[model samples]
Target: MIRITKELSFPLENILFSFALKSEAADVFDGHNTLITGIGKVNAAYELSKAIQHKKPSLIVNLGSAGSNYFQKGDVICCSKFIQRDMDVRGLGFEQYETPLSNLPILLEYGFEMEGLQTGICGTGDNFEMGHNTRIYNVVDMEAYALAMIAMKENIPFLCLKYISDGADDNAADDWMIQVHKAAVAYGNILNLNKNNISI
Candidate 1:
């Protein structure tokens, strides 16, 4: 794991938020620690791997924008389960989205409640094109599962929040590019409700 620690120190449980794009977190957090891990599962895993090992915060939160066919734009959702959408090797008797030989199912679960947010599983991949999964209410993102998996491995309490930016479709790429900034601002304002702003 690459160590990317800040010189500043804080108490335990200091919330560390990871975002794949700055637009997703630029203003979402006031004073809490945040990082732009770039877009895609590889970048997410690589950056987050370093983050957790270096800081070792009590909790990890991944906040970002997603495109969904079922969810409407601007709706904040809690990512309760994570599935690696591209992990398919059923030909060899592995289950869909199942991590091979690791006993770690590609489907990872984390349940945490927040008001006005729907709980949904996030299907993660490096590709932005939308596709199918066993889950019904799912969010399409490029980074959530990788971050969640790392968080799980490190035994840190984790939560993922997403704001739907577009319907996953031919227009999704363009729409997401335009909507993410506004979504970030809205998410940041929502954080105001946290008061202490660092709940698990």
Candidate 2:
């Protein structure tokens, strides 16, 4: 049970920037309060939880690389809705993507909507989506859902910005390797441009 304080004056100082890998962050977030939560939901949840315990942030901003079929490569998308793509328990009379007996909705909607940015429904899963059969989500990532969940539980404002590194196809691995390094630059530009305009 981490307590959040509303005394922070600067917006950037009160923001907790989260990433799944150091490669995704690069040197853009050099001196800021950034957390590299490794990969996947478990790591994302554990690392973010630990960080919040030390100091609760007013806002949790998740910046990462993601694969998408609907959006083009090199596009930066603002995601407000999240889904656990790997959660499937239809066999147990539970709805698809629903957490069994948890009372959580299949699509968890909570995040700041940035102006002039395209919004997307992000599907977070353990597996790297190469085929991407469903139209339910346009963006696919490995950790945003867990981070978003923690932020929701903590009553903290959350924002997720995903850079499209691949097209979620057979060439996704190669494309991701090439485009992932550019995510930091994209995020940096967006933040710098909107730093004064962003309310949360």
Candidate 3:
């Protein structure tokens, strides 16, 4: 088991890097313990949560590609807060995205900082939502919310980093495919910069 302390200077080896797709992490993080969690929230939540329970890394760093109308293509942003955009059960006297009974029902936050990375609000859904957006969330993804929520429940420090691959337009698929590799490389740079942040 890994211990969480006030000091934030752990070796990169103790950090578990996660990716939704292998190609999204290709040529990057070649020698690290990166988790390729398939795609979407179910895969990420089940796999990552299981791993966290078993291995208990000091930190989890989720890196992948995302769609955005505001963030520039190839821009890597840190997800400090996450929300589930696809959950709509307001008819039952609850908010649309609220994860019922949780302390922070609709939102989960990762309390940490990374130098040279801008904190962004990320929204996750099962489907790839194109052109559907809100001003509150700049990044749209498929896995970050589930990953962050699980980490919070497990009391593990989590950081989500994403590269903007598309503009939430019709051309998003093609753009995502083309830019996934680039995003992977950029994610590597962040790991190198903050290698000591993960607890050894």
lDDT of 2: 0.88
Per-residue C-alpha lDDT of model 1 across residues 119-147, encoded as one tens digit per residue? 78888878886443345446888898888
- The reply for model 1, stretches above 4 Å from the true place, is 1-13, 28-31, 131-137, 193-200
Q: What C-alpha lDDT do the candidate models reach, one value each?
A: 0.74, 0.88, 0.79
Writing each residue's lDDT as its tens digit, candidate 2 over 97-193 gives 9999888899999988777689999999999999998998999999999999999999988889999999999999999999999999898887772
TM-score of every model versus the real structure: 0.83, 0.91, 0.88
Cα RMSD, each candidate: 6.4, 5.0, 3.9
Q: Which stretches of candidate 2 lie over 4 Å from their true place?
A: 1-10, 193-200
- Clashes in each model (backbone N, CA, C under 3 Å)? 0, 0, 1
- The candidate that achieves the highest lDDT relative to the unseen native structure: 2
Candidate 3 backbone collisions, by pair: 10-198
In order of lDDT, best first, we have: 2, 3, 1
